[model samples]
Target chain A: MTADFLLSRYPYVLIAVLFAIGLYGMTVKRNLMKKIIGMTIFQTSIYLFFIQGATKQGATIPVLDPELGPSAELYINPLPQVIVLTAIVVGVAITGVALSLILVLYRRYGTLDEVELLRRMRESA
Target chain B: MTSRFESIFLFVVARAMVPLIQVFAFYVITHGHYSPGGGFQGGVMLAASIILLRISLGEESYDRFPREAGIVIGGFGALAFALLGFASMAFGGNFLEYALAVPGMGAEELRYWGIFFAEVFIGFLVWGALVAIYDALESGGVE
Candidate 1:
């Protein structure tokens, strides 16, 4: 795309770039810890994308105001924020679980390297 | 690990800060209904306080919270939330219908209390569960 197009949709471009970086980390990293970091990055990009969607061009927050009254057009979408909130907790919970499992794996194999871990598993079996 | 030497400076600073953190966490939980924060955010704060203590003071830091207390508190919070729903149902109301849970109280007041209690329980559950997870990760006693 042209510079103008990219500049006009900077948030989207940023989201795409973040998504790519996260994907790269997840797929190309050797250490399991790095992969987890990549996974967290990927998740962050998705969250940012949702947050971007939740905003409106001219609308304000979802909170009610006496002057603004109860007009739907005056407020930004609230559902996406709620969704992101719940998703964040779930993400953290899963991340904790994943980290604990990784801890156990390292305890057993004595290595965080993905390839080394696989090799050790085979040797033990 | 538990074998690591304890730092007096770390312990003293963490001990001093833990109370402030917990107080703020309580404020966040209680004022959540009218503000941006709610149960999860406050609960995470509580867990973070514990984590700070754990990092600085080591195993002995768990004296206040304890390892087993995490799951117990979390389970109690979960049970409270569930009971709130069932209690409403027992009053011949649909699930979570707080207005019906109380026979004569106004609908608005009942609903407010219901949501408030829900937030409280949610905060407790999140705080305890997160602490438990952190403990598990730290211990890694999966023989």
Candidate 2:
């Protein structure tokens, strides 16, 4: 019974662990770059969760095979794959924008340490 | 930024590979209907090829495709996509109703064309936007 439960729930457990790690990194790390990396990790966990949900035990890939007919049950759900594709592109865009903002912040402040940057901002304000 | 690497091997291999990558990207976009590839995947691949050239060849890469040009191309692609959606509205149908937009074509055929054109526009938009982002990052955050 334990083995069966583990087999059925391992993917969710993995996702939860990954999300916890990302959250820890984002909240506990003081370096801005590390925080950005954490954000990436968080995004990755969500992607993995979506992909895991889309998988089936006996289903094939969501490709059309002439011999297989057009039965939807024969293939995995394609909607999640499509949504994840767009999510990945959006992730890249978000990362790029975040990095650019970090670049500007570093240029103006000369430090990537979050505490130091916050102090600097307070001084300026 | 104008520094060129002095490696003959890198230059020759990259030059040869760029065209092949571009051809494959086009194939992915055009054959998306029946395959695993599509507009976003192909566009990223196209952008990857250009970025490879930039990384290996340095400033000379900008001579072929300027940073400003990328932004303009990206804007045009977005405009094209929005205009296509609005064009459907002009034909007295809801947005993106491709059959009504192009009268006299079979509904299925119109849908096929609509998806194709949308993919093409998205391909261009993604390609140009990614390249523009790369350019901006390389320049080290807005002059």
Candidate 3:
């Protein structure tokens, strides 16, 4: 019975697992690059959750079909898709900026390990 | 980096594909109203095509679009978008209120043109900004 419930609600379960993994990577990873990868994974999970929520059984794409009048029920929710699209672009921009900053930091400190970076920060101060 | 990998096959393929990708990007931007793609997605694709050429052709890619032009184009795109918004306001409407942006045009036509122009500006901005970011990163050092 529990297995049946799990299968029926598999999307949420998958989302939860992805979120946990991303969180673990972000918090437990010691390398700065690893943290950036984790951040990307975390963003991926959120995008997946939003896109999944936007899906509906027997619903068509959000594009308007002239044959089938403009009925809200006939189409999947478009707002989430639109929002996620913008979010994806913003996420890319954020990642690009973050990577450039990391590159600068690496140049200055010659290390990408988080603990080492902190030590160097203290030494510099 | 460009000189390190000089393969005729890669060069030919990249050169051939760039134009096709650019054409598709324009199609996506223009047909966005009736399709899944829009300015943002199309703009990214356009940037991707140029980046592909840069990666494959190396220093030669700069001949197509000089490195300095990237940032200038990006700034221009953003300025165009802002000017459009302010133009609407100047015409006695709220910011981005397309209907009031143009005088004496039918409401529907005004809306269509407004959205079309907005998408074009956004496409230009995104394309330029992404290319500039790539150029900045690809160039060694923080200078």
Candidate 3 per-residue lDDT, tens place, B1-143, comes to: 34425888998898799999999999998888788888899889989998898899788888888888877877888899899888888888878887463567898888788888888888888888899888878885553
Give per-residue CA lDDT, model 3, range A5-109, as digits (tens): 999999989988888888998999998888888898899899999999999889999999999989988999999998899899889888889889998999888
Top DockQ model: 2
The lDDT, on a scale of 0 to 1, for candidate 2 is 0.89
lDDT of 2 by residue, A1-125 (tens): 98898788999888889999899989999998999899999999999999989988788989988899889888999998999999999899999999999999998889999999999999989
| Residue A63 Cα positional deviation in candidate 2, in Å, after optimal superposition | 2.3
Residue B2, model 2, lDDT = 39
Candidate topping lDDT: 2
1 or 2, greater by TM-score: 2
Model 3 segments beyond 4 Å from truth? B1-4, B101-104
> Model 1: DockQ against the native?
0.64
How well is each residue in A12-90 modelled by candidate 1, as lDDT tens digits? 9999999999999999999999999999999999999999998888898887777989898898998989889878887
lDDT of 2 by residue, B1-143 (tens): 43568899989999999999999999998889889888899989989998888888898988888878777877887999999888878878778877454557888998899889888888888898899999899887654
User: After TM-score superposition, what is the CA distance of residue B92 in candidate 1 from its true location, in Å?
Assistant: 3.5
